[model samples]
Target: MDPWVSLDPPMPAGARARAGEPGGARELVTGALADGTKRGDVGGHLELAAALGAVVPRPASGSTATLWESLATLGAHDLQLARAVEPHLDALAILDEAGVAVAAGPGATWGVFAAEGPGVRLVARPDGERWLLEGTKPWCSLASHLSHALVTAWVDDRTRGLFALDLRDPAVRTGEHAERWVPRGLPDVVSTPIEVEGAAVTPVGAPGWYLERDGFAWGGIGVAAVWYGGAVGLARRLAQPVGRELDQVAHLHLGAVDQHLTASRAVLAEAAAVVDSGGVTGSAAAALATRVRSVVVASAEGVLAACEHALGPGPQVGDASYAAALADLRLYLRQHHAERDLAALGRQAEHEGPWWTTRSAT
Candidate 1:
């Protein structure tokens, strides 16, 4: 039997081949995980990413569907692996956007440490012809393992800049407060604090360019794609056949899961098209991301609830994959920002005319 149903629409035979069809991401990840490679092994995950380099298309490269599908495939197999690889891909995309040449050396893994927290600040200052970063950065996932990172730091009180730095630099310290990241979901993917003192860095783009670029929105939607995939992985448990036939109640839950996943997949596909077409720019891209993320988050949450209702505690305890997927997805979906993002979308939608109007109605 197939691992999971394909959430994407049909594509041309040649396009499918280019999009990592046949034994692509699914085979690579499945084979790796089966070979005693732990999900939390950051080094092993980086090797997987390197192996998948040929297949995983970069976002907005006219094969956005392919890129997302590959990510979904990873998430389906293991969310921790997906979590480890997604930021590396995003960092490469960001560097490409800023016209920086990516010298991806052997085993060179990258991450984006852009999250800011209260009372913790990383500052960047001019150092002759180069830039140096000081202070601390929070939410640096897999920091100890990653060789490079794109860090966002305050250049001034009102300005923040994005800089690429070598994590191996002696001035950079990771795993501060290491004991604080005790979570059930994604326990292997530890996100800790890092401290850097006068670490030499390379500026990727102008101040504020990271958030202003259209890729920022595109990256956000990419994360939603992973969430959708993780939910799909969880929902697959419902499809497994036991010795006896499933009753009507089980069937009902499966149907609902299908509905939610299908909707989420549709929006992601639509957003990918918009991004590749370059039809939306500036704030429009942000709006598109907000809308896509909102739809995916709701669908993922609904699927999560339905899976728990349908499968009950048997799979939760009996199936390691199912249980880990459940926890990882629940934690991963929290990245959506919940009500705050919805409120922002609401503010944007208020000025638009009607929400329910169809093209035929117009």
Candidate 2:
């Protein structure tokens, strides 16, 4: 079987053309995988991200589909690589949305450390003309490897603001809680807490602007695209020939996988179109993102179950790539706050009322 052949859906015509170009995203990832690059190799993954950064378009560009396609292609190749690259792309997008010029030197990778935790709070205080972040920020993934990060810190008792920090700042320290990240999937992509004292930061957008912007919704959906791609990667493994006659049960499972992936692809494409058209804004963009993410989550979970039931323990135990892919996807899907997100979507729908009404023909 061809390495690229699988249950994966077709990319848009333009996306396919860009991906097929020599030294494009597809060629870069395929070459890296062929060279036996490990998923946990953060340095190698960061380098790949820097190279792809020059090629992949930012989200909501006229071709949002191409941006998502690039993300999906990365996820399908290696979830850990996707994990490393996603935030870098997201940081760039956030900066763009905030009207901040990305003036970093070449090969400068970034991460967005916005997740807040109890007992440790990062706060930004005015220091003359500059802002200084002082406190601990949890879930700073690849902080040590990255050159800069767009971090969220408390600006006051009731507000949080986005700030950009240079990780190389002498006041910044990482690996505070590294040992706590021992999960089997994407184990190498450690999200440890970081401590900062008097680390100078540049304010990105106004306080509360990060979460309020439409791009936040678009970024969430972009992540779901990556999840969808990881599922596609797993589904492709199910179609791999095992040098033996496949049974009916296996074929049935493959069909089910196709069903889920097809639905997921449709939703992602629709979401991309909605984003590009600017039809959804403010609360509506968040609602659309919630809906798209919920659907993709279900589809990815279904694909995982189907693959496990169909392939049995043989591949899980014998195939290293299959095992790693399954593990990485499992852990990555946890980012979707499952029931909490569904409940939020439910609230949004309830407030909107009758969201499924058909339009009248003129």
Candidate 3:
């Protein structure tokens, strides 16, 4: 995979050999989270990455090199789970549990698994102290290999629940969703739909992890990173061979995206810092974080649009590569989270700290 060629780089080598050291997509995510945990409370993974690199920085370790290659894991679903592990998580980077019970439980081990849509349903009930789950989930990004899945289920049909189910058990069936498997965006991204009937599960923590709590909104990071990567690829593809328009737009496009990326970094850093220091659970800093993401996504869209104009009609239209990336990214743009997440940012804006608050003095 050539980032210049396909806006995606080739997958790294030797998963079998690297089995113990930061191997697989989940490990990569775990490594990244571990890195962020060392730094602060950031949730937007890329921003956390940037903050790690640009702000606090990660400990120099060989594992990080693998972590860098693991970035490609997000793109893995496009190539099936095995090929998708590296530098990106098959582009399924966004993972948010509606509640703590869902986000932080045992099945949270499968937090690396990105569901097809954010509309993942979880069904949890009390069977003594342990909870049991039964429901269908589509778009389990790494479901092929993911042994656990963190989900938000319904409680008593009135409220919802979050559960972490161990997919390792034969009782918990794991396979691609035969009924519906194709997604308009991220094709080859086998977000396998899942159906768990009476699957043995466990409760992660309490109810706080599963709800639309503070940290829930922090999920924009991975999605933003993948989309950003796609935008970079598109813009790179459209980069003018020697033209006035595409070439000029490329510089402007990068500049605009840089501002958003920078601000987003700052916001995420603050959010992470707040969480790290125990200043807030999640929402204390989500407003600015979401705002930064909004800008980043908007600028990324501009980059895509400029790519279209730069490459001209015939090339982009005729080329299979452009069509593929465009289709996938376009679908992401339409998802419930993209727009709704921004709406979330807007809704929370009123309650943010002084940094994001309206200035009456001005």
Write down the TM-score of every candidate.
0.91, 0.91, 0.60
Per-candidate total of colliding backbone pairs:
0, 0, 50
Best by lDDT: 2
Candidate 3 achieves a global lDDT of: 0.46
Query: What tens digits encode model 2's per-residue C-alpha lDDT throughout 233-330?
Result: 89888887465555899899999998998988888888877788988899999989999999999999999999999988898899898999999999
State residue 244's C-alpha deviation in candidate 3, in Å. 11
State the RMSD for candidate 1. Answer: 3.4
Error of 1 at 281 (Å): 0.9
What Cα-based lDDT does every candidate model obtain?
A: 0.83, 0.84, 0.46
Query: Which model, 2 or 3, shows the larger lDDT?
Result: 2
